[model samples]
Target: MSAEFERDGTAWISASTGTRWVPVIGLEVHAQLATQSKLFCACEVRFGAPPNTLTCPICTGQPGTLPVLNATAVELAVRVALAVGAEVAAESKFDRKNYFYCDIPKNFQISQFDRPYCTGGGIQLPSGRFVRLTRIHIEEDAGKAIHDRGDETLVDLNRAGVALIESVSEADMESPEEAVEYLEALKEIIRYVGAGEADMEKGQLRCDVNVSVRPQGEPWRTKVEIKNLNSFRNAREALEYEIPRQIEAYESGDETRFPRQETRLFDVRAGVTRTMRSKEGASDYRYFAEPDLPPLALSESFVERQRGLLCELPEARRRRYREELGLSEYDARVLTAVREVADWFEAAARLSGRPKETANWIANDVLGGLADPKIEATSIDELPLKPFDLAELIALVAEGTLHSTGAREVMGEMLRTGAAPRALVAERGLEQVEDEGRLEVWCREALEGREQVVADVRAGRIKALGAAVGPVMKASAGKANPRRVREILLRIIGEDE
Candidate 1:
């Protein structure tokens, strides 16, 4: 902690000489709405389109063009509010947030000013820390600025006027880990509610991170805004880098350089934040009611209907997966983090008549084979593997018909062809060797080969039994029922005495 240099409008310095500083973060997330049309125009909200082709007079800010609110956009915004337990306002209005950029042809953005549609909600992270939200408001997105082809910046209006919901959070997050968790929790919530895809790379979701360091137990002030954090990893990285930068600035006794409240651009390549511009206060926006659009009014029935549309959110699913299904918190969180994954797991759990085993199978086996070979399945549609087949596969493992290794091979074939687990097992001769005589022969043969291990086990060195099971399993090509092989091995070993 360092002493405050005599005053400013919003800057603060630590009162102590050397107390440790901590970061406080708040996020302003702009998530594209899950709609096909733009917020004010009927332009299709499609990405990767020809430049300016998706634009109409209204979205292009042409003269005599009036904007009409997209009813679906408001409902989507309300859905997000209700999903996060925010209070939905009966009446909200759009305002002209004046600004100038190459992408915004109108030189202003239609956004919610004082009366946002939804206010007061919070998302709880996996660590159980709840980051409070300020408001969720509907807005129209600007066009894209393509800077790649030559020096002159080109504007593409394909994404212009797209529907977006801005979620502003309170500065409750204290560390980089907490900030990343908050972002992930927000992304999961948006996906769960069917609000948006929330993929950062595709520009479906974007974040502006407000990072500031305060002495322990000090109030927040002099926070710098890092703009356009495109990914959660980058968001975490920005915080990790910026928090220390500010602390060092404060420690350097440079009053003029540090503790300035301004917006900085996160240089993704260089991994540093450079000054973009001085941060604007609310008055700088000159927000006023949009004369073209009327005040948004929602019927009580409409709000209730949207509320009913809220399905089992990720957090609730997480709790149910852990409490009722007996899954570990880590496993439950992974399964429920994606809605389709949770849906698949639940349906499979019921079909297989086993909860925990199904979860383990999905988390460990089925999910591992989804999209990337290194990562596991996160969604049902990621592969040809069906939930019913997954359930049947788990049942096979549970009933001791397929050994663990054989079950994995069966699941692999199931993902490849959408074949029934039983069919694959039978086709591959994967049924566990349950015949006592066959297992005894394999066990005795293993004993004949590994007399040293048998001697060790017979002398009460039970740990050596693991060494003997492998030979029996190998002899049976991994189709041997491990428990039965162990039983037969003990029988053979006991006779060796």
Candidate 2:
């Protein structure tokens, strides 16, 4: 029953053998806590600032400096822990994880070792699969080392003491797709709770993948760690490449070709994983409690206070949108993708009392307008228009005060000038004319020279009604209520019958 492995494009095939291999996957995600100051000092915490400008003595690890914990950082971290349903500890302390990377100013990271602040929570995928968490510990990030400039490696210390929470998940994921789902779920919760902006592009969220492959119904084998995966695509692609690479090595029965327990980096250009360094054990870090910083003691009331700050999470909001608002699945999902946009939409929906129509405006108009090069804002929060204005605009359209086309014009002007919807409608002469007499005149004028179109309408060919509606709209300069024009044309034709 022995066979060799062959490369079948992206998948590895077992030649003449029915061998099934499964990958055990987990992720260690480091999310930067949203805070104004560094973890242990008063230095400002910002991205893309000049290098070495945000460092102080405590963050830089000077001989006589002491690290003071940031209360805001702890508050933000606790909010995330609560959002994920993690159990926060009553007392947790920081330990010095001894490492000697050039980015570490102290040659040791102040981190949680034996006692992390929270434990035992998980994220549920859209498919209802729960990826469990092992622990979430608070730590400080190291500085960046730039090596792309010729042969010289440069160091930037601005990020040295930025607060971070490292959430280590259990090996519960069976596939790369599930791993990405877990990451996206985690990022949503992080942003929803105002804990952090988990933007991977700006280094706010970084991930490390630990994966091992073994034959089905076998015990776990030595796992390889894939680092430097900044994007979810890289994470999935790395796993796709590493899993088969390991399986092929084992099927070859070459002891020397077998995978080792080491860290590797994903080469995005080559679409393969390269060896980084041998994976170190916990003993290699030489963990020790920090003598300067005291143990963090949290009161139950304080924990409860942070819990109150959490709003409806994305999943709950999405469910509510579907159940209460009667929105379609696509609309529910799109509206809840961003917390700010979702909140704006909820406010507009409540104001307009037209949840479905409000969702349409947000999905079809507001979000669509953001793609315009003329709009400087990337998100709803940055736009000049408000929820109240959107609600007014939606109401105008729903009540027949503005035709859909006129409403869109008014919305465009509102976006450009931040003016009231009614003002924009009046100033642009975009209001729909619903005066019965005026509408009948335009409808009759449209049907005057189109006897065949009028006869088709009389014969109940509803599709031909567009011919009459088009002229009425054009004669009124696109300010006629289209529905009313269609009704008037039908009434006039029926009266002549």
Candidate 3:
């Protein structure tokens, strides 16, 4: 592949034996806010609530039923903006996007067009590149259309007026990897802030991809907007399909045949972008300021108050885990991947007073066993072995009172029987055997029995050391401190002074 294809913000396309290039991808993702009520109505925003059972007069578009803004929804949007490092505008307003659809009872969506609530933010990927955010606007979602198998379309007013945030980004992305990273980062920030569930499987988060390509050092070509991509795989597939199709058309010397200013749908199963309709510009919507609701006015003091309530975002928390707690990058990423897991780690760390040890066990043992549903039912707070109990077990290993292998057995027993760590260790006689005399006798006998391993050890074969330790541990039934066993064996074999 050419360096131009690798770094010039273009998608590399391989055809048979050759490669082509396409440039510049951007995405717009809409995440539904997690407010209990709809954006402009009192109707409950509960999912799966028997079709239109949650609808009210205002949401159903009854005459003389005026809409009211949900304060919680507005606050949630602002919180999400703050989490993503967006600037909160002191004043923003809504507009009417006129359209006709079976799902939209009002025939117009209340959205922000000219001015949005927040703007100018960015999300950094693990690769250290930033995808600049253009704006995050507040809007009201339309209703849902349930089409029956018999060609009958039923409208459900339940989803009407639901709060949603339209997160638009600048065309700064260069590849599908960057796109996925941006989406992951955005989802993490939103999840941390309690803004929305952002589950693409549930349609709570939807993404539309905008892609255009041009030769290196040239201006971009006409862009095509692909809509209704539900998953990250579909997003990448859509871009992949579109980039080649456009390049093929352009290369055929048919500029007029290429897609011009149109909306397209990604056929996930077929892996292609199909024409939906001619894309409508903002002017086509005849957007005008909403007449009913007053402009949303937020005070600087109010924005500062919201900022004060913001929690440390995932990136910052991950950095603290690495810098302050001295955790490995992989460990830090695993712990801070979810807000709940991060909280669990912090609480366990504090209680254990052994941050690294607690993190290790949580990452290895606790998380490994999380698949058992019965174990999952017990909250971390209610676990039989408290963080301190595990800390005590770790202390034993660190102090050479218990072998690392013995500590593991004690931990397994603690999980199964809910017994105290120290008590279990005592009752089972699982303490490390560190007596110099006792270990020396065992080592000498082992050296006589395994003459070949003893010969190799004397010949400076360090790998044969494990050959000796393995039998010693087996003879001790896994109770001997491994470090002491190694020390005694080395002294007898003359490998130690």
lDDT of 3 by residue, 68-132 (tens): 78998888899989888899998999999999898888788999998899998888888788888
Question: Per-residue lDDT of 1-497 in model 2, one digit per residue for the tens?
Answer: 23455544223356655577778899999999999999999999899998898988888899999999999999999999998889999999999999888899899999999989999888878867888899999999999999998888899999999999999999988787888889999999999999999999999999999999877778999999999789999889998788878887887789998999999999999999989999999999999998888999889999999999999999888889999999998999899889999999989899999999999988988887778779788889888888899999988887778888988888887777678998888778787786889999998898888989877876778799898899889999998888888888898988988
Task: Tell me the spans in candidate 1 whose CA falls farther than 4 Å from its real position.
Answer: 1-17, 372-379
lDDT of 3: 0.81
Please, what is the whole-model Cα lDDT of each candidate in the order they appear? 0.84, 0.89, 0.81
lDDT of prediction 1:
0.84
Best candidate, TM-score: 1
Global Cα lDDT for candidate 2: 0.89
Each prediction's TM-score versus the true structure: 0.92, 0.90, 0.90
Best by lDDT: 2
Alpha-carbon runs more than 4 Å astray in model 2: 1-18, 435-461, 488-497
